[model samples]
Target: MGAYISTFPTGFAGLIPTALQKLLPGAQVVQVYDGLVHYRYGGKPGDLGKVFLFHNTFLVLREFQGPASQMDSMVRSAAGIKSLPPSRGSFRVRYSVKNQFVAVPKERTRQLEGKIAALTHAKVDRVSPDTEYWFLQRSEGVGFFCRLLGRRQATERDLHPGELRPELAYLMASLAKLGRDSVVLDPFAGYGAIPKQVLGYFPYAMVLVSDLDRDRAVDLRASLGGKRGVSVAQRDALTLEGIPGATVDAIITDPPWGYYEEIEDIQVFYRGMFASFRRVLKPRGQVVLLSARKREAEAAAQEMGFPLRQRYDTLVNGKKAAVYLLEVGPAL
Candidate 1:
């Protein structure tokens, strides 16, 4: 087995352990911090790329806790570091201090490069190395020496304003707890992030995505309509245009947060949204959504009789937000 570390969005750390366990049946969660999770797995380390919540995954070469002065010695003496596996060509080192990405000091970078060269006879390539290592230093003097496992490849789609990250999109989709035959919907499908995640990771019979903007709807159809069992439409989510009542299994979306557009009264807007949610969702169906307008969302859901099942406070693009799981109740 090998020790591995994964970084996720803050406040959703608790979800990582379960996600890893589901991905790898024999995985054991060693620790869970604010935005990081450490686990041990017997399977191929590269397979960890399947985890959607993880922004990055690394193989832990060493873990230590002591004064900052001991970091160099800790790296040199670490048993895991002594096994100098063959590298493609060159290597480079990076640093993360107190959860913030920072440039490695020239002296420290050179020192680490020299140590690696002495151990493995490899040269240093700072710009584009075949292998990269990250040394993360925590606030309490804890340190983790990690080797990057998989790099995120760029996609063809350009990110739009206020777009939800794919990692967070998968997180919200997982909250829905849908079945293989369930039909899912994204009412406000801006670029279809949530619907795309649901289709990619979760089991669902069909996916319905709609947006109020005609241009975005065309884009969604062009990008997503070719897929099997995907339905794209240009319609106001508050009214849910042609969808019948009590049909959808779950509604997962990132509604307007009164930022790009003006929402005179968020509560009133949510009430209208919930009215459609009540009509379209099957009995006991669920609604999992992300919103920065917490008070208004919870208040409106409660007022509309959708009992809150669970809520995860997290950050989206450095902005405070929360994911709420609400279930249809008697009031609905």
Candidate 2:
């Protein structure tokens, strides 16, 4: 097992660790920063949707006083790596300064980049941003993730106005704890983001998707094209007609909230969605939903008699949002 680091969004501090734990059960995961996790495992950095970037964790520093000196030390650390030689080697660097030190230095990024080029005698070609080096501010001091990969956003092919971030999507899927050949559904299939993520990570029996918009239906069909056992259609989330009850293994969805989507009645929509979920999901099946309307969803769940398994309060682009994981009533 090797040391590695993973990154998630600010509000999702716990998502990365949970993903690592689920993906590689019994793996030891420790959080070292706001959105960072260090784990010792032999797993390659695949199957991680919510994880932005990960590295082999070449060097682990416990302190950093300032950028200039820290960059010097990082360059020296890079020099010691087995394969980092041949100055002019194309590379990238990521500095994750703590929130409290947001205004530490403006030229820090540039200086660090230059130092890497000068010390390694390698040409710095940042076209890839592969995170050749990682510097993070820990509680004790600033540390460096000498060998790192950073800023991995293309994991999702289809993009929309309010697409679910990769980390959140992965986290939701991981939390479901589904196994091979499980059936999954996404009611509000915007750009098919949640469905695509679930499909990408898990080997499911079937993936059903629907959207209220015609264009979205077409887009979802295209996005899920050629994938085995996938179905796409145009339909309102509040009414997922024709999906047989007690057949679905899980319902993973991202409902439209007030900020980005224009809904006439948010509460009514939430209530209707809860009803739909209860209908389609089989016994012991889970529903992972992303929404900002917590009270509405909670009230609907209570009224609908669906069991709330867990809820994570977090932010999406600074706006208050949450991930709700609910379960169907167990079969008698």
Candidate 3:
């Protein structure tokens, strides 16, 4: 087994431990700190790359727990680990302090770079390197020396404004506790991030996604159509126009947060949305929703008789947000 560390968004750190336990069956969760989880796994290291909940997953090369003055020596000692293979082409060093990404001074960065280069016997390419070594210092006496695994590559469909990151979407989808035969729905499926995640990672009997915007709905159909057991539509979320009552097993979506759209009363919007959710959701069926306006969402959901089971206070693109797990049940 190899030791590893994975970074996630700050507010969602608490969820990563349980998420890792669920997603990587054999992995052992060692510890969790702000924005990161350390674990040990015997599975293929590359599989860590496919887990969407982590922002960056790294293989722990060494660890240090002492005064801050010994940081340089710790880095040097970690670089000297004989089991570490030499780098092939190019490599770089990165630094993180207290769960935040920050830039080290050029002189300092270069000094660290020289140590890493000597160990790997590879040239340093600051921009777009073939290898990346990260030094994460959680506090004055705790530091983890690691090598990043499977650096992120940007794609055309990456997160955009008013869109959810695929990692967060995966988390939201997992929160629904779905089964292979579950019938899923995303009534506020803008850009279809949640549905796409469900289709990509989870096995479902059928998926229904809809958007209020005609253009988006067309695009969703064009991209998401022709897939087996998938349906896209242009419909209002408030009514879920054509869907039958109590047919859906789960509703997972990131509804409007009153940013781009004009929502005069947030409670009114949530009430209408939850009312439709209650109608289409089977008894005890779950709803995994992301909302920035949590107070209003909770109030509206309570009034609509949905039982709030769990609420994860997280961040969506630096905005305060909450992911709620609700179930169709008797009025609260």
Model 2 ranges with Cα > 4 A deviation: 1-4, 11-18, 21-33, 40-97, 100-119, 122-135, 139-149, 153-158, 329-332
Better of 2 and 3 by TM-score: 3
Candidate 1: lDDT over CA atoms? Answer: 0.83
In candidate 3, which residue pairs get closer than 3 Å at backbone N, Cα or C atoms, i.e. clash? none
Q: Please give the lDDT score at residue 232 for candidate 2.
A: 94
Q: Which ten residues in a row are the worst by lDDT in model 1?
A: 68-77
- Runs of candidate 1 with Cα error greater than 4 angstroms are 22-27, 65-83, 101-110, 125-128, 139-142, 154-158
- Writing each residue's lDDT as its tens digit, candidate 3 over 1-332 gives 99998877666666777778777888898888767888999999888876667777889988777764255655556545555655778888877777667675677777777776776788899898988888888874678878888645543356565777888888889888889889999988888899889998888999998999998899899989888899999999999999999899999998888877899988999999999888888889999989999899999989998889998888777788989999989644
lDDT (tens digit, per residue) of candidate 2 on 14-113 = 5666556755665577445555566665555343433343323333433334553354464455444444433344776655545332332436556666
Give candidate 2's TM-score. Answer: 0.72
**Model 2: number of backbone collisions:** 9
Cα error of candidate 2 at position 87, Å: 5.1
Tell me which of candidates 1 and 2 scores higher on lDDT.
1
Residue pairs with clashing backbones, model 1 = none
